[model samples]
Target: MTSTDSRTKEDVSSRTKKVPPPMYKVILHNDDYTTMEFVVEILVNVFGKSLEKATQMMLNIHNKGKEICGIYPRQIAETKVETVHNLASNKGFPLKSTMEKE
Candidate 1:
């Protein structure tokens, strides 16, 4: 190929390598006052988890004392955590959620 074509290809490849996928983690913390039902509901509503999946996640947090709710890009994970936390607080539940780099 021409030198110009090869240079263009190299530039494209370098650009792709520089743009990495952002990472985030959504975490649910265990708490005494947050009901299992509420936790499951938050999982379902906020995280778009199915009923079965929500149940399993709630159980994991209960049994293991904490669980990673989901992994998403930074904005998504932050939004999920904020939404869950708002719902819980509004409902008078002490359920806590957080996000961190994965």
Candidate 2:
């Protein structure tokens, strides 16, 4: 390619900016019907949290009645919350989860 064309292409590439991924917070709401054991299991299995971390989070939810489970990119956070909700519902529990912008 010509030097002029190459320089023009490089300039355009340098000027173009990539849009950053949106941030989201995944939250878990406490419920009487869902046992703490189930919450811990979900945290461990779905969120890849360690057993101790999952227990701590479960306790937080129990005492605080709600807690932010984790932060992630928008789509991923939403998906995680949705997966947890569905799993809880399928297991006949009233557990609820949601995601919002960080």
Candidate 3:
């Protein structure tokens, strides 16, 4: 192929390659006042965990003081943290959630 054609093909190939977005892990922190039942509920409802898995995670949080709930894109991680906080606050619990690069 001509040099111009080769360069155009390279350019098109590069343009077609997509890079995945950076991911973040959403973590739930344990606290004295946040009930285990509530934590399990959040895991099941917000993170879409099954009852058995939610209970396991809840136990992990209770015993270890924290657990990573899920991995998501930055906006989704931020939204999950905010949503957990809002729900906890509305119910007068002190459960906290945070996001970290994955």
Q: Which one wins on TM-score? A: 3
User: What TM-score does prediction 3 earn?
Assistant: 0.90
Ranking by TM-score: 3, 1, 2
TM-score, cand. 1: 0.84
- Give the distance in Å from residue 38's predicted Cα in candidate 3 to where it truly belongs: 0.4
- Counted clashes in each candidate structure: 0, 0, 0
Clashing pairs in 1: none
Candidate 3 residue-wise lDDT, 42-82, digit = tens: 99999999999999999999999899999999999999999
Better of 1 and 3 by lDDT: 3
Model 2, runs deviating above 4 Å: 1-14
Better of 1 and 2 by lDDT: 2
Candidate 1 Cα lDDT to native: 0.88
Candidate models: Cα lDDT each: 0.88, 0.91, 0.96
lDDT of 1 by residue, 17-89 (tens): 8665688889999999999999998888888899999999899999998889889999888888889888999
Report how far residue 66 has shifted in candidate 3, in Å: 0.8
Task: Output the better candidate (2/3) by TM-score.
Answer: 3
